[model samples]
Target: MLSGIRIVEICGIGPGPFCAMHLADLGADVIAVEREAAAGAPSSLLNRGKRSIVADLKTPEGRELVLKLIEDADALIEGMRPGVMERLGLGPAECAARNPRLVYGRMTGWGQTGPLAQAAGHDNNYIATSGALYYNGTPAEPPQSAITLIGDIGGGALYLAVGLLAGILKARETGQGTVVDASIVDGSAHMMQLILASRQKGLVTGPRGENMHERSHFFATYRCADGHFITLGSLEPQFYALLLEKLGLRDDPRFAGKQWDRARWGEMQAHFTELFASRTRDEWSALLEGTDVCFGPVLSPPEAAAHPHMAARDIYFERDGLLQTRPAPRFDGQAVTPRPLPQRGEHTGAILAALDAQAASVWG
Candidate 1:
């Protein structure tokens, strides 16, 4: 739906590229600016479909080139830490001075004006400070990181993409641009609102494994006979009944109408541990794959790419000899596949020539 929008991304390591990739897939024209060294690297799936430009942000000419690109862009995204852009002369104030309608997007681990804004950190540190990491693992262990998904991709990339798009809309309507401070810490904290509410209402509580969402027999993972694991989340009453019937436990006196008996959860889970182990992952999946029991097999990345569902929908594809995911959140059941990844500075001359041609035409 975002067909004609234009985005210029000052490429960084993680979230910035991901956010730009999402935009490009949604039909936006995305240009990626990279350092000279980075531009020379081998094909990365992250740089797919972007017109890659190699520029030295530290050099005056390079900085000026980026400034010129920003002049006509609907939005500009950057993931540098606090004061880094200002030092490079590409900060929000200067960019806004050039084009008042430009949406300036700033991405960071900590927010632009926080105590840790200037501190060096990563996704783990941001989620750690946001109280998000505390609820992940068993209480016996320190909080698990969830491997940067919760902070870097979910909190950082997704939020920046949403903020930039929203700001672009407002700018187009009122000709008044805005700055989006898309901080991973802030987004991670915001993400906890739902769980925080659940905790307040006593629906979700205790240390990690003691909560209903975690420890309950109907909402846990079980090991199969083959040593692989399968997960279950038969939360609703009908689904719970179905699971019990499928497990041949409906007639067992131990589970007769004991769904919410929290005191019996451990016993129930123990029973499940023994029972599910009787069958292999394939066996259990064959019995309850597409049912209302809310089940999915734990799959590695390659396995997931080869899954039947993935193959049917083309969720993953090959481009330039690299495996990459298709654009997500389709529009009217349609999403665009990104073009091939650009080589180092592949479109530098073309982009510069196009800009000069447009400039000359307007002036002449």
Candidate 2:
């Protein structure tokens, strides 16, 4: 969908390349600038669908090469610490001077102007500081998050991609460029608004485990006979009723009370734990998988990739001796075929020659 849009990505780690990859998957022409020393380095899955060039940003000539690319580009993405790009003479102001309508996207953990902006940090630190991590795990344990998903991919990369696109839209309309400060801290906090709204409604009151989402047996994970896990989200009254009916517990006095009865949750949970353990995950799936029980088996990566629904949708595939996912938010009711991973600096000479040719034509 972004077929003609050109983006210049200053290669960094994590979210920056990920955002560029999403754009590339949508058909953007993304040129990833790498360090000269990184030439022929092992390619990353994130480098898929992107062309690569190597230059030393510390040198004047190297910085100029990137600037030249920016001259006709729609956006520039950088994930450096605040002021690092400025020091390299390739910051927003310089790039905007070359292409007035460029969208400058800055991805970082702490954002551009906060006290912690210049401080070094990572995915976990950003979400922790944002208060989004407070309610992740069980109350008995320290809050644990899935690695890099919440803060890095969801908050950091996804937010930056949206910001860059929005900025590109605005620039196209007004012919004026803007800088997008896409910070994981800010984005993760913003993502907490749903839970915060529930809190305001008193549905999420009390201590961590005592909250409605946590305190109920109807909204938790249970272990089966085979030691595999399954989840239940029978939050609504009818769904809870269906779950009890499926388990042959509809008439049992222990589970017959209000679904949110905090006083009975411990006893109810104990009963459920014993009951679910009577059957293996597959057995339970046979009984309740498609009803109003709001049930799902907790699957590992490979298990999920091979599941019936996932395989039917072709969501995951093996490519280049690695597992890869198709581009998301699919268009035209079709999955976007992932492009090949580019070898590091594979297009450096060809890209430079194109630049030289463009300059020659302009001068002629």
lDDT of 1 by residue, 90-154 (tens): 99999999899999999899989967889999889999998888777654567779787999998
Q: Which 10 residues in a row give candidate 2 its minimum summed lDDT?
A: 34-43
Clashes of 2: 0
lDDT of each: 0.87, 0.91
Candidate 1 TM-score over all chains jointly: 0.95
RMSD of 2: 1.3
Tell me how far the alpha carbon of residue 130 in candidate 2 is from the true structure, in angstroms, after superposition. 0.9
Residue 34's lDDT in candidate 1: 81
Taking every candidate in turn, the Cα RMSD to the unseen true structure, in Å, is 1.7, 1.3
Q: Please state the error at residue 77 of candidate 2 in Å.
A: 0.6
Candidate 1 local distance difference test against the native: 0.87
Give lDDT: candidate 1, residue 289.
87
Residue 316, model 1: Cα distance from true site in angstroms: 1.6
Q: Give stretches of model 1 more than 4 Å off.
A: 38-40
